[model samples]
Structures are given as structure tokens and as C-alpha cells.
Target: MDNSLRALGDRLRQLRARHGLTQEEFAQIAGIGYKFYQDIEGGRKKEIWLSTVERLAAAYGLRAWQLLMPNMPEGSKVARKVASSRVHRR
Candidate 1:
């Protein structure tokens, strides 16, 4: 996979968690198939469409270009909340 795509996948995972949504929920909000979203987040997709990116950005209340930024949010409070919840669940 391209490094940029990998980075985008990482950003998507972090953003979805920070928004307090499971992958399935986020996929629904983006109006995409759950498995397709999984592929995107897993970096298995070869490419992503602009429309898809726009939908994802809208779901996160952000602009598409923001989502494409090389430096995006990471290790924030909301992300920590999601991380802790996963630990508790296990």
C-alpha cells in the first residue's frame, strides 16, 4: 500500500475512535458499506474516490482537505476515551 494511504487509514481510525464511533457506525454515517469502510481503514483499498472522502469528512464535521492533511489529530482525550473503553470491554 502507498504510505499516504496508510497514513490516511491511520487518521481515519483515530478520528473515528475520537468521535466515539465504532467502525460500523462511522461507515453508516458516511453512507458506505461497512466492509468497504473496513478496507479503507485497513489500507486494503487501492484508491479512494473524492466523493467518498467528502462523505467521510462530512461525517466528522470536517472539510475533505482537512482529512487529507499530513498532520491531523492524534492521542487526544476523545481517542483516549475510546482506547480505555476497548480495554474495559476486553
Candidate 2:
């Protein structure tokens, strides 16, 4: 896999974990097939379309560019809310 793709996969895994979601749950929320998402997150996929990126970002209530950033953007309001809710649930 390309290094960039691996980096993106790592970020995706981290974000999904932070939101307290399983791969299946995140795939369902992103409206993508479980196997396809698994491939993406596992860095086994050869290519990723812009639309897929958009869909994944939408599921996180973020923009595609934000998702692609080298660092996790601090602009995710939804992430903050979800994180706080997870804390409360615990």
C-alpha cells in the first residue's frame, strides 16, 4: 500500500476508535459496504474515490478535506459532542 494510503487508514482507525464505533458500525453509518470499508481501513484497497471520501466525512459530520488532513483537525464539533457523550455513557 502507498504510504499516504496507510496514513489515511491509520487516521480512519483512530477517528473511529475515538467515536467508540466498531468497523461494522462505522461502515453502516458511512453507507458503505463492510468489506470495502474494511479494505480501506486495512490499507488493502488500491484506490479511493472522492465520493467515498465525502461519504465517510459526512458520516463523521466533517468535511472531506478535514478527514484528509495530516493531523486530526480540531474543527470537528460533532466529534467533540460524541466524545463527551461517550464519557457520560461510561
Candidate 3:
């Protein structure tokens, strides 16, 4: 992992744009604070909670790793493991 929250946030914003969801709408669906998402998008946070990631995954119809590694295609090892881990609630 690059551990670059800003890059991850940028990817998130890009993905949200691709899905045509506004920040408010995506935050509502993802169970996150609009400002928090904005902060994340703004690169203000270096660490993001797992709960937020899980919420985002569920709401975005993706596994945690899909969002975590959003540029990769679906079913990649990271996404698969993330999905599998989520299935087991690990």
C-alpha cells in the first residue's frame, strides 16, 4: 500500500464522479460525514478508519480493497481477498 490518503481520496473522488454521485449523495449512502469526505478528498487526513472504508465498500457496491485499490480491475487478488475477508467479517 502506498499509504497516501490523498491519492486514495483522489481516486475516491474520481470513482464517485464516474458513478455520477455527488459528494452529499455519496456521503449519505456511504454513512460518512460530508465534511469528513471532503477532508479526505482534500488530503487533510493521513489515516482513515476501517469502519469508514467498510461503509464505503458496502454503499459503493464494492469490496474494501476495490476502494482501497480502485484503479485495479475487479477480481484482482487484493479485491478478492478484501471481498472474501468481508464475507467472513474478518
**Candidate whose TM-score is highest:** 2
Between candidates 2 and 3, the lDDT winner:
2
Cα lDDT of all candidates, in order?
Answer: 0.70, 0.74, 0.62
lDDT of 1 by residue, 8-72 (tens): 88999988767788987777666667788899899998887787776676677667788888888
Order the candidates by TM-score, highest first: 2, 1, 3
TM-score of each: 0.77, 0.80, 0.69
Query: In each prediction, how many residue pairs overlap at the backbone (N, C-alpha, C within less than 3 A)?
Result: 0, 0, 0
Question: Against the true structure, candidate 2 has what lDDT?
Answer: 0.74
lDDT of 3 by residue, 1-90 (tens): 345676677777777777787877776666566777787767877676787677666666667777777374353221211222232221
Backbone clashes in model 1, listed as residue pairs: none
The C-alpha stretches of model 1 lying farther than 4 A from their native spots are 73-90
Candidate 2 runs further than 4 Å off: 75-90
lDDT, candidate 2, 1-90, per-residue tens: 888789878988988888788987887667677778899899998788787777777778889899899889664433322221121110
Report the C-alpha displacement of residue 33, candidate 3, in angstroms. 1.2
Q: Compute the lDDT for candidate 3.
A: 0.62
